[model samples]
Target: MILIKFLFITAILYLGPVVGQQECVKKFMDLSLVKYRAQNIGTESMTGQFMASYTLRVLWEYQFNCSCVNITSLILGINIRRVTDSRRLFPSVQVFTPKGSQYNLVTGSERIIYYTTSNVSTNGMIEYPLDPPIKVTNGDVLAISQPFKKASVVRVYYINGINFSSSMEYHIGSKNIDTSNFLVSNELILVYPVTSGYCVNSTNSITAEFVKKKALEIQRSQPFYYLSQYIYPQIVFSCNGSVTKWIFGAYSMGSLSRPELQIWRQLGPNNYNKIGSSLINATKMIGSNLYEFIPEVPLQFQEGDMFGVYSNNMVNGDSLILYEQRESGPMNLRIGPRLVSPLSTISFLKLYQFTNDYPLVTVEISQSTDLEESSTTEYSGSPYPSQLISKPSQSLSVSAKWLIGGIIGAITIISLASILVLACIIVFIKKRVNLHNSTDYSIIDTRKDDTKKDDTKQDDTLIMNDMTSVTPMQDNSAYGSTHDAAVNENPAYDSYSDGTYLYMSNNLYATVDEVKQDQDDDQYI
Candidate 1:
């Protein structure tokens, strides 16, 4: 019982440092700190609390919730706590391909690697490095099938809480797992998963400041000239991973308040679309004429990604963002000019390649963080001990803005079509109103002519009434016939200053002198 207590304390010391290790995958990983944990299955009450012993064919299986592409785990290091200290029998280390739910039916690997209890050294973790690295697929499964007798009992640790842990289940001796009547545990496989994500001798990853320094050094060393034309530049990345840095050459281009040119993202061979405004805005100058774009949240790309920049060729030397035009460069770097065209056209990324000086731009790539820690189902999110789970990127990324961009374009087209229909309706209504007003005006003009004729008739009637009201003196001339009877009675004579009387009879007006002269000559007689 005293020996059982010592092993339990030793297990805690081995795993305590895990809390203080770097949260992210670093350039180098320790082999001892990077493998998963198993539960202690001993029946002894005191011993079973910290360490578990295999009761016959008990198989410990754990599953990852992600698909592994360029990721692989080469070393298998385990801390076998306690055993009989001398025995021929040991546990079987095995691998299995995953089907549905990671806990799915397992199709075992080609060969099973065995670990013997011949040298039971509890000083530290035991290491086994495979000659060929393990091939990983989507939802890969790693298992340990324990095959031992009662006296030859060996114990493994059942860690209650830790990072990079997978959900564990108890299975029979075979590699295959049966879902019916299966049991789960309060514990998880505690692991410090280290990978070859970044190597010590790797030259693949770099920073934006480094790229900027290198390009400036090249410019000063050799006599370099700019591409003397307004152009859109493109750099086709040959490496396959998420691009973390994009450095543009610095020049005396006057300060721009907004993005002068467009930046585009290429997902596939022919797929091209405008990236978010966050990427193109280089208004934030770190120092002098230098311009660099570093996103607050970086996106992952499994691509030979190509990027393009559009600028005005007619602008002055101080107008556009400048990059060194290199006559000769790394053979891996393939860059040229991409003419601007409408996004709807298939000819948008017009790989209209040019053969000479290339843009002195820098690009770098890194492995995805998807290999960090997968989601745990049965053991995770439970209200047990919350402080143990290290969920750093627990709440972000995997955004599909590219799909969203296509949806927005479709909405824009629909909006334009609606506006066009509304315009046509307005034009049609305007024409109908104009035609109605023209017809109404023609009828109004005819009514005005009739009104003028009626006015003339009224004036004529008034003149006749005035003449009929004048009383005329009765004519006594014998020559007067029926014409004299038609004369109107004269009211009064209007005399003038010359003593001439105005005689108006039968609608005829005459002066008094003319009437008197006629009487004097006996015209009446």
Candidate 2:
């Protein structure tokens, strides 16, 4: 009965009010991660997207913890190819305390306790609930690892927008996650994460211009067909720095369609690659105009690098691309020297492929991190642009966090050892005290027995040897003085000849008297 009552009370205490609050919150609030899902609304999840995957795909999202909120679930859209053997895709999610940067996520003492769900069968989106929601505070990183093997293919969406460089990290082959192996792409994953509370909207606005040596030298804007991706191949070794704003022929398809700026770099002669990119929902105007954009994460460019424009929106291709005709014929926008202001340097002079009509474009470059940005609630409305997630300065530094953790761990181990040593000392002291007291008690008891023996013994009597017992004196007269002295001398009178020897030594010729006295005392005492 007692156990039953205790269990009933425990059940009431745990499951009762929590369920009530959850129901209340669910009924009253908009539970969807509507602010983060601003871009994917109305259209298919992967609309205007390029799908790419690696040997090992690991995406780490730096969740902006506006409030101490619980992430209830994630809406994941993964494409799984047919498997031949016993292989299956297992999509999993794990949470981590923000320690080091996302580049070093797999290193050090990691909390790798993962929650795995059943395999996603199709290429559709599914809301995998977090069974028990994972709570997150400010500066926490959420890791999403989709089950993938070499045989299976998973659709990874890549578009333009404000996102971290480490957001879409991939590891190749069976090797561990190395910082160098991560891919920096133009994919801004606005993954929808249902939160139990409100998350701040990520909206960004930047107004900057590209570099221009001469402002008055205007060029004609030419019309060109829009491709999925465009880069300035000829504008290599021109102006190199962080691009703040890019103006391509005053208005390319940028004014007609939404495009993300992709920064491509040339590491060696044949080693050209896309290093960074930005996604923004800049407004499309009616006529020719310049489009302004800002990246959430800062992008750096070298001296021999070029920038490009990308769009995942294949549905709208009737956009304008600014280019020039130096060979006396209409040229392709894929070919460089589009209407961009030149630095008039030796490298810029040798970069232009046309000498005739070329579309004029401008790009602004800055060496400092002083770009002004304004926020908005536009993420909930129009095509969501992008914003940089600012890290807190008040939080512990990476080195400080490591030091404090080491100190705490050392202190814990030392404390446990000290407790064990103290406990052993206490036990030893208790046992020593018990043993000392017992020894004292034994000595005291033995002394008490010796004292009683001394009290019964005569003061002048010297015990030459140990005796079994002493005979008590008689109250009535049983013998003469000689018999009394002889009886007193014998500690125990037995039928032995020691007393006879003593009597003969005291009186040599008194054998008859001694024998008569002994016979009188006892026939065989």
Error (Å) of candidate 2 at residue 405 is: 67
Worst 10 residues of 1 by lDDT: 487-496
Clashes of each: 12, 23
Over 4 Å off, model 2: 1-62, 80-86, 100-125, 146-150, 153-155, 160-185, 200-525
lDDT of 2: 0.35
**C-alpha RMSD values across all candidates:** 48.0, 45.4
Model 2, backbone clash pairs (residues 3+ apart or across chains), number: 23
